[model samples]
Target: MLEGHPWFQLEVLAASGKSAGNKYRDAANWILEEEMPEEVGNKQVEQIDSKIFENAGIKLIFSALPADVARSVEPELASSGLFVFSNASAFRMAEDVPLLIADINGDHLALVEQQQKSRPGYIVTNPNCSVIGLASGLKPLADNFGLKSVFVTTYQALSGAGYPGVPSMDIMGNIVPYIHDEEEKVEEECDKILGKFTGEAIEPLQLNVIASCARVGVRNGHLESVLVELETDATIDDIKNAFTEYKGNKDEALPTAPEQLIIVTEDESRPQPVFDSYNGSPERARGMAVTVGRLKLRGSKLRFFLLVHNTIRGASGCSIMNAELAKIRGYI
Candidate 1:
């Protein structure tokens, strides 16, 4: 998306030691040769090393490295005066780091100034892939009716496991009921993302959040079943309208901003990953929208299911949107 954007330019492509193999290198070469033939022009993946920070012209770094690797280098990259928008779990919950969801809480970017006081550059992160969808779905409800507690059970995609992912034999016809620290990340990150940014500090929401995560057989899109208790009574129509009416910085004209952040579906069979996985509007925003279905309201409680493209709105596209938000907010 950044490559296609008018304001942004594609810079260097760096790879970790594990991803510097012939296969990965060849793939990067192929993409440059085929898709970005004119612009990239014979570029090859450079090994990410100490000298990687030598590029003074590079102002931003987008990273999807493993947590430990990211933690090891992010500070150095930031200290080198390069803003980092990362997808790794490292530094996500740091009080000085902003866990950003562009439309939902762009105000969180305010924390960047505080971070810059300590380092020349700063880091911003998107939530866990699964958490992005759940948080996006919850934001509207929390804004309209206020949330008391949230319970989510996620059916995450295989690709979320990264390259090589889950062994086909283990996941071909099975559902693994555990996914590392996914549940805990979701539970904690949601509160911070949905919380208030009081200029000086982030006050996490006091709502209760419980999560159960599993790896499913699907190739893309994380699907979740959520049950939420509201702080106040509201009608079913009111709940539906909150979703339909919700728009997160859509009018800002950000390159990757989805026309509708949340798409509330009325069909009982809708929001399936196969069809709704790419949900969004205005072409550029495809795969950036969260689709919600099977909404059920009982008194002040609500039940629903949502889908988010695990790698797009949940991962890389999420980081791209954060960069755009930062640029618009003058942090980049």
Candidate 2:
């Protein structure tokens, strides 16, 4: 995605082990079917060293580092005067750091400026994968109707665990009821994303967010069954209008910003991962939108199923969108 961006280029690739100093195409092959395109495939993979940032004129670091590694490396990269757009969990809930969902809380990116006062540069992060869908679905409703409480159950995909994700014996035909740290992350991050950012820090949204996450057998999109009770009474049509009418950050023209934030559907069985996973627009922003379906309402309470492409709207693509918004707003 970095290489394909008009303003960005895949200047350098970094890795450890034998893959280092080799072509990116020849690096780790975790997904056998998705070959690295020759365009970026030919770039040489280098060791993860600070020297490369200056030597290659790299201004941004799009990190998909594991949380344990990010806990150490990300601060160093940010201190080296490089903007780090991380998908890792480290620093996400930092009182000073911004757990940003570009469209939802672009204002939180302002936290980077304050962070830069202490560190040489800044680290801005997208939220946990599951929180992405949950937050996106909740934003419009929270904004228009005001949230009383949110009860969400996630049917997460296999790829969310990363390549070679769940072992065949444990997840091939079964549904695992829990994912380590996922539920807690969802509850905490949801409050932050839906919260109001005070100038000094975020005032977490004061609402009950009950989340239950599970790993299912699907390959891509993360599916959510959401039951929300709004503070204000509304009809099902009002909720649908809130979703389909949501236009948070699209007007900014960020490269990865989807033309529509959410797509509301009427089909009862429509949001299954296979046919409804990739629902965004303008080609460049495909899979960046959330698909909401099976919406049911009872007075102030509403229920719906939402699907988000975990890798796109949730992780890497969200990281990229944050960078684009940062660049436009001069935060980078």
Distance from true position, residue 276, model 2, in Å?
0.9
Candidate 2, residue 155: CA error in Å?
Answer: 0.4
Cα lDDT tens digits, model 2, 93-187, are 99888998889899998988788888888889899988999899999999889989889999999989998779989987799999999989998
Q: After superposition, how far is residue 204 of candidate 1 from its true place, in Å?
A: 0.6
User: How big is the positional error of residue 162 in model 2, measured in Å on the Cα after superposition?
Assistant: 0.6
Instruction: Give me the runs in candidate 2 sitting further than 4 Å from their true place.
Output: 30-35
The lDDT values for all models are 0.87, 0.87
For candidate 1, the TM-score is 0.94
Pick the lDDT winner: 2
Query: Which lDDT tens digits does candidate 1 get at residues 154-269?
Result: 99999899868899999998999999999899999999999899998799997669999999999889999999999888988888899989988765778888888888898999
Instruction: Kindly state the number of residue pairs that clash in model 1.
Output: 0
Q: What is the model-wide C-alpha lDDT for candidate 2? A: 0.87
